[model samples]
Structure formats: C-alpha cells, structure tokens
Target: PDECPLAACVNILAPCRSVYRWQGKVENTTEIPLLIKTTRACYAALAARLLQLHPYEVPEIIAVPLVAGLPAYLTWVATEVLSSP
Candidate 1:
C-alpha cells in the first residue's frame, strides 16, 4: 500500500479465522495481517490511505498499542518512521 510510513513491515497469515454473517449465511475466512512498525504521528494518514485504496467496502485495520518493548527495538521502530507529524 502506498503512503505507508514504515521502512519495513511484517506480513503473515493471521492465526485466527474471521467469522461474519453475509446474505443469511455464515462466512469464515483467514486473513493476512500486516504488522507495520511506524510512528504514532503517521498512523492517521496511513490508515486513511489504506481505506482509500482498499478493495473491500470495509477493511479490518487495527492499531495495537506498544506499552513496552526492548529500548533498542523501540528506538529502531521510531527511527524507521517519520519524525514529523
């Protein structure tokens, strides 16, 4: 996806299946999730870009907060993304 602020990201097949009702039937499917290491300053624009270009009417985009991590790893993540808001 364009406009992503991360210098690198991890994409993997999600472990759990997504279940929902569609047209009076239950639909279950697997999804590939992308874990992007980006700065908080870039999240809004990044999310907007994904929504604009996404094929689905509704895409599942979730941002998990990083409460704690190795200082070096966190620093690496911060450096990979833009510093300016």
Candidate 2:
C-alpha cells in the first residue's frame, strides 16, 4: 500500500463492498478497495506492481477506462500518476 501512489492520492483508503460466487455459493465481503486513479499509460505498470506486492495470488486488478469525467478531475489523475519528469 505504501509503495503505490494511488494509495496516497487522497491520503485515505477507499472503502468498498464486494460480492462474488465462490465454492458454489454466493458471498459478500467488505474491503478497503483502493481506487487508483491513474492514466492509461500507468495502468500496466501499476497492475504489475500490485501483482508483485499483493498477497493474494490473483489480486483483483481491474482497470476501468475513463470514458468521461470532469476535465479538471481527469487532469488531476494524470498529474498524480506522472513519473518524476
């Protein structure tokens, strides 16, 4: 968590509730899901890093493309993920 910039984006962990089927039964769970608001260019790298650092063998590394968002907010995401340059 400390190694990921998204975890620090707002200085707070995003709260989430997840539901899925497992072992032939539906289950629900609550988790501190971190929504890493990063650019397309950063998705792959961030995902790879998460896989390496995450304890789960198959971490829930899903990337939902930003089709539309407030322009200012999208710009902020881009800036937040920009590598030192």
Candidate 3:
C-alpha cells in the first residue's frame, strides 16, 4: 500500500497456484497477482520499486499496453500518476 501512490491504482487479484521450473526442478506455489494501472512514463519507476520490494530474485514484471480503454478512466490514470512524485 505504501507504494500505491506511485501509480494511479492497483488491483489485487485472488491468489492463484503457479507451477514453473527453476534450477532444473519444477516448483509450485500460491501467488497473488497485482494489476497496476499507470502510464508508460511511470512504468520505469514503478518497476524499479517493485524490484526493490519483491522477494524473488527474478520476479515477474511485465507491461501490457492498453490498446483500448474508457477515455475518462485513462485520463484519470494519467492525472493521478502525473500528479504524484
């Protein structure tokens, strides 16, 4: 929550089970994904901060561009992020 203001908002999703291979072995774990809404301008700072906070040595951090969205909502995201430090 402390890092929320870095972006417009964050959507915490339900915990999901993940299965992946690491160090030549398969592993399973429960993880709660977060959907963060922010502009491309803010992505670098947000990702850098997440890297500092995440526990994993290589946490999954990827950006998917918004091809379409409600105009007002998109504006709000820009406004909120721009207004932040």
lDDT of each: 0.71, 0.70, 0.87
Which candidate's lDDT is highest? 3
lDDT of 1 by residue, 62-82 (tens): 788888889998888777776
The CA-based lDDT of model 3 is what? 0.87
Can you tell me which runs of candidate 1 are displaced by over 4 Å?
Answer: 1-4, 14-16
Ranking of all candidate structures by their lDDT, best first: 3, 1, 2
Which regions of candidate 2 deviate over 4 angstroms?
1-30, 83-85
Candidate with more favorable, higher TM-score: 1 or 3 = 3
Whose lDDT is higher: candidate 2's or candidate 3's? Answer: 3
For residue 78, model 1's alpha carbon misses the true position, in angstroms, by: 1.1
lDDT per residue as tens, model 3, 12-73: 99999999999999999999999999898888888988999899999999999999999999
